[model samples]
Structures are given as C-alpha cells and as structure tokens.
Target: MILWFTIVQIAVACAAGLFCLIAGLIGRRPSDYTVGSLLLVELLLLAQVVIGIVAPLTGNPPTGDLLEFWVYLIAAVLLPIGGIAWALLERGRWSTVVLGVVAISLAIMLWRMQVIWTVQVA
Candidate 1:
C-alpha cells in the first residue's frame, strides 16, 4: 500500500466521521454533500483495493495475513453500500445515524489497513 494514500484515506475517513456525527446530532438527514463525500471515500477505497492487489501480484507480500487483508477490503467496500441502503431506508436523523456508523466503520478499517501496512513493512 502507498503510505501517503493510506494517510489521506485515514484523514478523509475521520473528517467524514465527524461530519456524520454532527449531522446526526442536529437531526438532519444526509445532504448531497454527505452522500458525495461517502462516494468519494468509496472510490478511494476501490483504488486502494486495486493497489493492494497489484502490490502483492508484483511480488510485494502483503503486510497482514491474506484473510485479514480480505476482511478489511470487504469492510471498506461495504461501508458505502450500507450507507446508501440506510439512507434509502430512513429519511432524517436516523439516516444520518446510519451514516455515522458507516464513517466509524471506515475509520476502523483504515486503522486496520495501517496496521497491516506496518506489519508488512516490518
């Protein structure tokens, strides 16, 4: 994994988490901006998946166990999918709460990814 890109992803995830929390607190539904940010995060995650696969293919062994890597990747991909689904199911603050959950999940995955990267580097 690219260190810089991972850092960027972590930062973005934290910000999104904060925004989601605020939205939930204010009893506000997700706005276009919120959805757009989540989509952007997912896009970045997809890029990470590609890069992660390519790195291993090119003879760079993964930092974590293959199962761990796959788990993180799956969780990363599912966050946005879940967010979209929850947004559709609820119309207001509840939807934002769901988004907050997504953000938290994204942050956790990013941290796990970082740990994997560190293990790989060591």
Candidate 2:
C-alpha cells in the first residue's frame, strides 16, 4: 500500500484500459499489444501483492481492516488473469473491449484498496 506504487499502478491500469478500448473500437481483435498490455498490468499487480505482504513487516502496515485490504488485493490480482483468459479464448473485438473494461475496473478497485490502507484507518 505504498502511495507511490499505488499511484503508478493506477496510472498504468488506466493507460492500458484506454489502449485496449481504442483498439477494440477500431475493430482490432485481441492481439499481442492488447494482451501484452494486460500482462504488464498483471505483473504490476503481482508486485503489489508482494509489497502488500512485506510492507507490514517493514513497519508500513495498513490502518484499515486488514481483511478488507487483502480481499481487494486478491480480487485485483484475479481480474487481469480472468480478462486475459477471456481474451485469449474468445479472440474477438469484444474480448479486447472486455480487457479494457477489466483494466478500468482494476484501477477503481486499487483506489479503494489505497483508501482502506490509508484514509479509512483513522
């Protein structure tokens, strides 16, 4: 729940989402670009997972409910996996759109997680 890392994650997710949405709107099917962007997002999430685990040990624990933070984090990690699987299996323009939607959704979820980690603790 590092503020700088969370901000980077949000920005990356939004950029990836916008890219996929634009590509889908242009009638592009799921390609390496679309999938790779999502993979990048997924990688960031994985890093976040690790950070979430180690941060508390390093004296940066969340102020909010720990369970709530973990739940949001777990869900955030899953979203990209689900989206990428759907895009690969379906291989359609709509699948790309779905990826975009997932990315945007992930960004929103990350925001909530940040709130729970910092703002809601008090």
Candidate 3:
C-alpha cells in the first residue's frame, strides 16, 4: 500500500516477467535466472505482506475496502508459487512462458491492489 514500494514492486514484476518471457521465447527452459526472478518477486510479495501488516499498525491504513485489498494481496502471493510449481513439474519452455505470464499477471494485480488501497473508498 505504500506508493513507492508499490511502484518498485510493479517495476520488478515487469522486469522479471519480460525476462522470463524472452528467455522462454528463445527456446530456453526454466533455469536459475528464470526461476530465481520469480523467487525474487515472491520475496518482494512476502515483504509486501509484512508491510501491509505493519503499515496499518503504524497508522497508514488503507482508505479502501479492506477485504478487497487483502484478497488481492493474498492472490498476488499465491500466483508465483503456482507458477514455480508449474515450471518445476512441466520442465518445458512453455512452462517458463507460463511463469512469465504469471509474473505479468502479478504486476497487474499489484497495480490493482495499489488502487484498492489508495484510490477506492470503503
């Protein structure tokens, strides 16, 4: 919900998404770079979870629908986990692409979360 951190998350997610997408398109399978990028995004999302908790306690509570924000945040966290699982199980270039798509989807979701946190009013 922090604006600057949300921007950072969006940037990182986009970069990771594009990186995985390019790697997949060039006939690459899931590798450390591709998988690690997703892990990095996951870490960021986890950090966001902590921030989401602490931020409200620190008096930066969201002005929007609290339940909607939480749902988006939870979904954002789950997305990368699912993508990584798919990549590991499938072990194919398309799996890498799926990871890319997941990352991109996560970026969009994060953006929506930001809106829900700051723009929408309960």
The number of clashing residue pairs in each candidate reads 1, 0, 0
How many times do residue backbones clash in model 2? 0
TM-score of each: 0.88, 0.97, 0.97
Write one digit per residue (lDDT tens) for candidate 2, span 1-122.
89999999999999999999999989899999999999999999999999999999999889899999899999999999999999989988999999999999999999999999888845
lDDT of 3 at 45: 96
The digit string of per-residue lDDT tens for model 3 on 19-106 reads 9999999889999999999999999999999999999999999989889888999989999999999999999999989989999999
Off by over 4 Å in 3: none
Error of 1 at 120 (Å): 6.1
Off by over 4 Å in 2: none
Worst 10 residues of 3 by lDDT: 113-122
Which residue pairs in candidate 2 collide? none
lDDT of 1 at 77: 93
Q: Candidate 1 on 1-122: residue-level lDDT in tens? A: 77789889878877877787788788888787777778878988999889888987787676667777778888789879889777867778878777777877787888788778667554
